[model samples]
Structure formats: C-alpha cells, structure tokens
Target: MKPELISFKLCPFVQRSVIVLEEKGIDYDITYINLKEPPQWFKTISPLGKVPLLKVGNAVLFESAVIMEYLDEVNPPSLHPTDPLRKAHNRAWVEFASTLFFCQFNMVMAKEQEACDSAEQELRDKLTQVEQQVEGPLFNGEVFSLVDAAYAPLFMRIAFLEKWHPMGLLDQTPKLQRWSEALLKRESVKNSVVEDLEQLYRDHISASNGFGASRFGNA
Candidate 1:
C-alpha cells in the first residue's frame, strides 16, 4: 500500500519530511491540513495535534525527525553515511536543528519583536555553533544527509527573517550561511519550500503591526 503524509502547506516540519520523501524518490500521497481546525481523526493519530504525520500500512509516525528517519530506513538513500560514527554525527546535528535551532526561532516568531530579540540572539548563538561544527557540502560534506534535511527549512527561514528583521544571526555564521544557500539550490528543497504560505504569514503579521495583530486578527 502507498504511504500518505498529512501536513500543513506552510509548516517547516512538514516541509522537512516532504524533502526527505522527495530526496528518496518515494511516492506518497499528500494531505494538506487546516491549522485552525484539523480533522478529528488526525488528532487521534498524531496525539500532539501537530502536522507532518505519516501513515504507512498499520504504522503511523509523527514528529518530522522521526518520520524522516523512517523514510531513510525504508528507502535507503545514500543520504545517511555508511560509517557508524558519521551516521551518529548526522543524527546529532538533526536533533540540534530540530530541538535547539528550530525551537528558538519558533519562539521568536511567536512573540513580539522586543520579547523575541533575546530569543533571536540565542538562536544566533546556536547557529554559530552549527557553523563551527559542520563542514563541506551538506552537514557531513559533499553528500546531503539527514542533518541537512532536518535543518534546511529552518535555515531557509532564518535567511528570510534576516531579510526583514536584519538580525545578525547569519552574519556570525558564515559556514551555516554558505550551507543554507547551497542546500536551498537543490531541487528538493526548492520544491518543498512553501513560499506562498510563508509570504502570506509575513504579510499578515506586517499588516497587523505586531505579533498580537496577526494572532488576534486571525482569531
């Protein structure tokens, strides 16, 4: 049976999962979710009420990182390194990207600019660490790996936010900046990025004049 992915068009988490599937050349069905009112059954399957859920036969997977790992296992793309230590390094970076880097950025996006500045600084520190740690094309060099897949969307968003906010996050992290620019040039990353929704959100927030404007206005 074919797999199905339930996701939100603009979600970075969902985008990561889709990039993995696309890179692996796996065929799957895509279901776009409404963040305002998701389906009742989706909650049961996802538990956390978040998107980027995958249904493969009787198994269901949530969390973009886990879902990507499963896809990697099933499809066996050359994305993961053959060396056990290198594979661990790849996984380590993915965890850092998802939990540390992405979480900090999300916090910044969810709050007012003043409240978000500190968090944005924290994000920059994390990105700086990433820059120091990773080297060569992709996180593990030349070949794109799970680390790149997990962090690419967040990296892309950092670039976008920098354009508008002028935060010095990317300025201090030259390696990460180079990696992001290179990764985004890939067809999978290009196709997976939800530019329309990203732009819509940006416009929505800008028109509101603040985070509350976007939230309350949407409400």
Candidate 2:
C-alpha cells in the first residue's frame, strides 16, 4: 500500500517522515492542509487533531515518531542501531528532538526580547547536551539512521531561523555544527521540504509578529 502523509506544509515533525520516505526510496503521496483552519475530515479522523498522519489502507497512524518507525520496519534494513542498547539510546534521543522543537517554537513565539533570549538559551543548552551524544558523520557514526531523520527537521528549521535572526545556536559546538552541515547537505534532507520552505517559514514567523518577527522582518 502506498502511504499518504497528511501534513501541514510548515510542520517540522511531518518533514521528518518525509525525509525517511525519501531516504528509503519509498513512493508515497502527500497532502497538505491548513493547520490554522483544519478541514472537517481531518478534524474527525485525527485523534489528536494534528498532522504527520499516515494513511495506509484504512489504518491511520498518528504521531511522526510512530509513522517513521513503521515506515522503517516495513521497508528493509531498519534505520536503527543493530545493538539493542544503542537502539534504545537512539530512540531516547529521537524523543529528545521533540523538546528541541518546542524550544525552537518558544523562541519564535516570544513576544518580548527577554522572553526570546531565555527561550534561545534553553534551546542552546539542550543543543549543547545533544552535542555530547552525537557520534559523528551522522547520529551513530557514518551510517544514517531514523535518529538522524528525527533531528534533521530541527536543524533545518534552526538554519532558517538563524538565517533571519542569526542566533548562532550551533556555533559553540563544532561537532554538532559539522553534523548539521553534513545532514543538511544530504540529498534526502535537502529534498525533505517544500521548494519555498524558507519563505514559508519566514512568513510563519512574520505572521506571528513576535520577537522573532522583528529579527526576520528585514531579511
């Protein structure tokens, strides 16, 4: 069955699944929806009323992590560490990526400079923690895995956020910055998002008119 991804165009979580699909050479259909004014059908079907939903046959899978794991398993040569303990560690970090996303959103939504600074510091601290775990080339050495897919969207968004705001989030950590660059250059990561994703992301922050908006407005 060809999987159909229900997504909000700007959702980083949804982009994670898209990266895995592209990396695995999985042929899938994608349908974009307006998150601000979700359709009635989406409202009725989505248990959490959120995107990154995978529609496979009649089974609807919610949550990006679940969807990515399912896709990896059904496809061959799972994108996870073969070592049991290492795989669990990777999964934990995959969950860690969620906190980073929340922090990124908080930074973007901060209405005051102090609030934005605090949010940025929180994000930076978490990133520093992530820096220590990274093995190099990819999340777990040279081989790419689902853990990499999970965090690519965060790096992608950070790149865009930094472009407009110059927060230098990754600057302090050489290893993390290298990992981010390597991931960004990967064809799968590069093709994971929409063509005008930067503009769309900028528009999102611009619409918010938060502390982030003031920084990105001129760019």
lDDT of 2 by residue, 2-37 (tens): 999998989999999999999999999999999999
lDDT of 1 by residue, 1-219 (tens): 678999887678898888988888889999987887898888778878998899999888888888988888878756788999988887887888866655554544555856555666667677777887887656777888878888888877666666665656677767777888889888998878565866765655455455633432333
> Model 2: which ten-residue window has the lowest total lDDT?
210-219
Alpha-carbon lDDT, every model: 0.75, 0.91
User: Per-residue error at 19 for model 1, in Å?
Assistant: 0.6
lDDT at position 92, candidate 2: 96
Model 2, stretches more than 4 Å misplaced?
Answer: none
TM-score per candidate, chains pooled: 0.87, 0.97
Instruction: Quote the positional error of residue 197 for candidate 2 in Å.
Output: 0.6
